[model samples]
Target: MTIFRLPTAPRSLQKDQPIKFILDSEAIDCLAHNIALVHPVFDVQAFRQLALTDIAALGFMDRSAHIAAALKATLPAKFADATEVLINTLTPPNAHTERLGLGVFFYLPHTRFVAEYGRDHKHNAGEDPFDAAMRAQYELTRRFTAEFSIRPFLMHDFERTLKQLMQWLDDPDPHVRRLCSEGTRSRLPWGARIPQLIKDPTPTLPILDALKSDPSLYVRRSVANHVGDIAKDHPELAFDLCDRWLSHADKELKWVIRHAVRHPARQGNATAIALRKAAGGR
Candidate 1:
């Protein structure tokens, strides 16, 4: 394994603080070491070389994917087995999913691993790739947001994937429920846009409608974001949905509807403004 000495913060900051921003060499060492512990045959030294080489040039997410590529090289070619190793390495999640600390960033590369390689199309494992990928993502989201990773699967088999998402609307974990909306977002920032959804975002409405009244504010916030994404391309659909949500709008639903229409209301869409007002917004 690489001897990862912490990168010293430039002389500008406090002397004792090391720059621990993105996945630095130390992060890779730690991640690789964890994987080694779970999968005994994992070549930790090789992963170090692959993940650390040229890592300085990459940005946050690129660094994540670079490390994932390294894992893809070292781990078992069987997708299910590889993801299982990652699942074993997760720090057990607690009751609260919303305000977890920065430590969740440790799994960023794990999400990337599932995103890039989850769809094992030419499967030698005799199991559906979608099943493996979604299962992995369901686990991954509890540890770290799997919103980005789920996009590829959504694009691969829209209907098949969406069926599962619909079922997840009532998930016990807020993260899983949130993923039902967030993962299907039409224009999720930094996520692959689902063009079909953008053209007719109506498909996502049921998921939002199910979640608009979610107990967790964490889940409700994502519902708002998903609705906002709808508003961007198809304002009519969004306005209509907000209008319906207004029928029994409580404080939480009102907040979600207001946020869902915020941008459009600002852009002077009369319908959005009307919906916002109806939802008791300013």
Candidate 2:
């Protein structure tokens, strides 16, 4: 039910700062304010104090989890209602596929909140947790990457989640479209692992096929990484897909194939090397 819109200008010039610094006390203050704007009942003082206590020792992800805990403690008890507040807290969605800066990292705790506490089969008493969480990610992905949060849904309900992802292939936002491929990636670093996707990777082939020719390079790059993951597990499947794709690949598709095979090519796999060479070598 969310419509994502990207910003027309760039943001965040401080690329060298530590990633963890993005979620410092300043972040907590701002987050508390944002939630208060949308949720009249949110206790900004309680949320801030709770989120920031003894937080200097925590790392980036730990701080995110800690804030998520604070949000869970302070926000509405019902998952559905809480998700609405969190969604309202999100900034304007990013319209462009690339150039989104560290400003996007502000939502790490938001997505982390969804990933951690919202994993129950039915988070809300009566509402379908999958629907609630997916809707949040569908909008949040535009503001921040939802690839990490979405893995839990894939693990909990592969069929329903994959079906939803399939429907999103034609999404107007490039970020949403890219999520369809990146979220299903079996070997996604820092995300939940799905042994089924690692062992087979066939279920996602339809997803890959749908996105292989996508106009957005951002989407194609994610698809390439997905195939690279598959290549690690099922080189035969990966090789065959690349071989078949090469039969009629355009310049963009060719680049995807090359980048996808680079991992195996580094190890000197003959077919991988051959494929890379045929794709014109990155």
lDDT of each: 0.82, 0.86
Each prediction's Cα RMSD?
Answer: 4.3, 3.6
- In the range 91-116, model 1's lDDT, one tens digit per residue, is 66556865565566767888998888
Clashing pairs in model 1, backbone N/Cα/C closer than 3 A: none
TM-scores of all candidate predictions against the true structure: 0.90, 0.92
What is the alpha-carbon lDDT for the whole of candidate 1? 0.82
For model 2 the local lDDT of residue 119 reads 67
Q: Tens digits of per-residue lDDT for model 2 on 170-254?
A: 9989899999999999998878778889978999999999999899999999999999999988999999999999999988999
Q: Model 2: runs farther than 4 Å from truth?
A: 1-16, 121-123
Best candidate per lDDT, number? 2
lDDT of 2: 0.86
